[model samples]
Target: MKIRVEKPKRPAFLVPAVIIFLVIAAVFFAVHSFTETSVPLAYEITGFEGQVQIFDLSNHEWRDPRRGEEFKAGQKIRTGVDGILNLQVENSVRLRVKENSMLVNRECKLQKEVEIYRLGLDEGVIFGAMAKNLDRKIADNKAEFVVSTPQFDAKPFGALFRIQASEKADENRVGVLRGVVEVSRPGSLSGKGPMFNVRALEEAEVMEGRVQSPAKISAETWQELKEGYELLAKSAVMEAEQIDLAQKAGNFFEKAVFDHGTFFTPKVGYAGREFFKDPDSGEVYLETEYDVFPAGSFVGVYIKTRDFDISKYEGLIFDARRKGDEGFPDSFFIELKSKGSVLRKYSARGFLREWTPVDFKFNAQKPTLINEVVFVFTNERVGESKKGVLEFRNFTLTPKKDPVPVAPAIPVNVTDIVSPPEIQSTPVSEPSAAPSNQTSGQETFDEMVPQTISLG
Candidate 1:
């Protein structure tokens, strides 16, 4: 009877049911954990030129204070900040992302002989040097650097980007300093089909969720883009100009100086100097009437323009030459001034034995309408009293088409430190005992005229 009472009959399905329950519990835990703690893929942001950053999935947040923090790819980030994030690209280039920006690097693919990287720039600004991969067509041309944004795109090489502003604007805007760039929808019909190749440097505007044609952009914005390109492009020219300006003594306006019977002294100080080219000699160099030593040193020139409004020109362009050591100083520099204030500075670093064209902006990302120009030579290698040779030619300040009307010139009273009334072209014996009365005028020859050469 006791045995028959039977072990409480075990349910036939009890074991299997327990096992199933356990499995179900494990699955639930796994799913919950995944949903709670998983994150997007992170980008491998490193290169010879610099490092990169990724933003977390936070919209409309500022990252300025938290810069230098690592961000994973696919994690969304919005730039409410107002600064630039600098990253290295090529061994020789840098990439800078500005504030209020949204961008992502989708992929970095390295194939058998190709290294391809794709980036999605939603909004903001980017500045960097261009790299030439041995496997890509870029190595052949070098000038085609690619910049993509929601509204604009560009390719800037052998140059620098001072600023790129892409706020919620009426149009997509992209500009370059030196090299050429191509802009198009990578594979969109608006940019043509995937089979079609896009054109380089297309000026388009992004407005109301649509990218409009370049013709629709405002004159002011167009002027900004043009000015930006000029500023970036000027770096190379300034480098070459140093050599040309250093070699000559009297620069270009020797006739004007002699005709006016005014003695020109060397103004070798930092702020005030001029680079002039002979209208007839075709040789160019720096000129001043303040006897200061510029031997074996880098000096800059400042051109005081007539009281005229500068808003009309998008930028400045000129020609220059150098005949010194094959590769002397690596670069040259230029600066501008307005209303007794400094306007802009441009540096062109490279060689220029042949007459090369150079362009730079008076105001990048905007137009700074003023009438003064300054040329600067860096003291990169020169000691005291060293001589360098450089020549400038065919300088022109052409205004952008339909530029804002030139502003009327403002009369400025500049006080000079050196005032030698007479300049003797003939080398005076024993340097004429360091003249004491140093009172200089804007132009040593009170009547020096601005020089220009036709581009055509």
Candidate 2:
């Protein structure tokens, strides 16, 4: 200090420069913290009915989805006229897609603490619900579920809601059953249009990109909402049963010989077939009835196929049973055909009133391609009319069996063989007689018939 040492002078811009640097750093971090990070969400087909088709982005092809099939973002699902689809999303949301509808998974992302799901409904209806309890492990205010239509977007918060988009009518309808939904134009998320709050028991409609005021939900719509919930509940149970059935099926077959969902056309005399669900088991089966017809009549149903190959299979197996106490024939026929010409014929006989597994084994010299499968019920009883119902399910092709091992030949000398002495027979008391009404034995035959005759 005593020496005339000048204090190092600080730059006049030093403080401002430091402050500006801190400001830029803070700004950059704030923006970074607010930016959303993409999250991959799982979409699963919990259950489905009828002709539900999915356009998968992975392969860019439309195909039928089986239960428990997982889908990712950008996949589209469409339903046929009688189709219904159930979806479980991220273990937090459940959706029921109604018939004749098209839906797409548009976006899935994580923004800060919020998990987001955006679905697009190009047309038709969808019923959705958020997990209400802690069982789903989703915290409150942690998820955002939105369904967007061409006319509007429906944003539901912890709610059960239905959205129906009618492209032909140029309108979109939103019905809220629980919690609240915000109905707005398609770009309302970006503050582009007006929004309306649809509360429980209320509904609203959008026309020409304008959301109408919330109104009381109609009785018809209420019924529909109730049914949707019921269907969702049933689907959960159905999904569990389906998984169990699949596990039990194991690796026995490669493909179903006939699916319950397929359409069967009547090919011959006075026959009708319909899909029926068992009340006790909740399983669906095909119930085919042959009306009272004269002897020698052929009653059957046939499903069209396209180059279905069974060259690698050993046989066809199915479960079938007679449905009534009277008038059913003791036998039926299964035919694999190529363009209506018979390729193989199998006669299944002596099926009981209970479900029985029938297997028909065949050895083909070459690869067999079938164009159709026909189930024929014939009235072969002379001078008598026959009427009966039959139940069938689980028709599948069985895998080929492994070859048997051969034993080595053994040499024997004639002197080594000797005659043995016979013993006297012993008398024993017979067992008590069985019930008169009950038969002690039953037989079933699955004989392969010559394929010389065609049923076309």
Candidate 3:
């Protein structure tokens, strides 16, 4: 019987099969653990400018919050006289607390398809920008916000809006740059409806629970406010070098130093739109696009400083580039126009798919103050030649001469604080660039002639 017994046959695949099964189980466990343990969404302090302080609810004391610091519900933040605090809530909404302002977080929820933020402004100004399509999502899913102040409570829905609260002035303001905001008194109706609806470019004031009629702001004022807040945000995030360059250029975009007032004769053009993209750096500086290939096609962003005299800046420096392949001309004219007399201009030959510098000096021969800056891309050639996108940016106004005294600082009233700061000529802002041995001056025709396109 012993001799007849055969050794038990081993299952050839048992060990390997068991090992594979264990590996699969381990992977599934890891994914399951990750899904089960969720980290709650929190408000992150993305950046700060000047002086900022935070009041912790648990600590019951104000402390300086670090960049990238996580703030939970019930924490409060304050910005001093020249301070700015930039925060991203639920990863969808950007909330900026301006100087002498305060913000307190209430609740934040990152739902399956949307995010919600509830907050309050005790006093001062708040700039809020919601990402595109996020406003529509609020109506589709649910109410996503509730912002409260002493005067009224609001639920803002849209891309850009602002709320300014002044306890001292007994004022509450709501301005919509892009979207709509539904507002009502504190502890008023729950679901029945909101009291007032403020639309894009519309503004309203609530004083002591009384909501005033909404009024549409002027296009110029709206543009100023938009630029003001954008500059604030940029300043909050900009590096040391970036701030230095921006300060030097007088911040044409942010400071609203210059504007494309009217085209002397524009065949084809677009304004305030993203029309140019850089080739190497890929940075879009200014929103100037022209596709005129005719005999005399010219367009420029004009500057109107009747409020002040800008006789100080004797020169201009900026970046310009033509868009397209080899068909378009690289020549353009940058004109510095003075209201009463002749205009000074520089003819430039430039490179397509790259940025070229247009640096010129304005003669003190004519009108005391420079009025407008215009770029004309004219092909005095035979006929309609080609199409291209002309872009401009990084403007540097040369050494400010003996500047006239700026008018007295405008009084900041309830309405005025909300208005954007207007740039006047007399009050020449000193560029914050470190004084180097190098200086900005007129780049003569002979200097850039070979590189410039032939217009004549």
Model 3 earns a TM-score of 0.43
The 0-to-1 C-alpha lDDT of every candidate, in the order given, reads 0.43, 0.67, 0.60
- The segments of candidate 2 whose C-alpha lies over 4 angstroms from its true place after superposition are 1-36, 133-141, 190-192, 231-456
Q: Model 3, residue 175: displacement in angstroms?
A: 1.2
Which regions of candidate 3 fall more than 4 Å away from where they truly are?
1-39, 111-114, 192-194, 218-224, 227-456
TM-score of each: 0.34, 0.43, 0.43
TM-score of 2: 0.43
Q: Tell me the lDDT of model 2 at 193.
A: 74
Q: Looking at model 3, which ten-residue stretch has the lowest summed lDDT?
A: 446-455
> For residues 282-325, could you state the per-residue lDDT of candidate 2 as single tens digits?
66666665532433567676655555676677776678787544
Off by over 4 Å in 1: 1-53, 56-77, 128-137, 141-145, 151-171, 186-203, 207-456
Query: What root-mean-square deviation over C-alphas does model 1 reach?
Result: 24.5
| Ranking according to TM-score, highest score first | 3, 2, 1
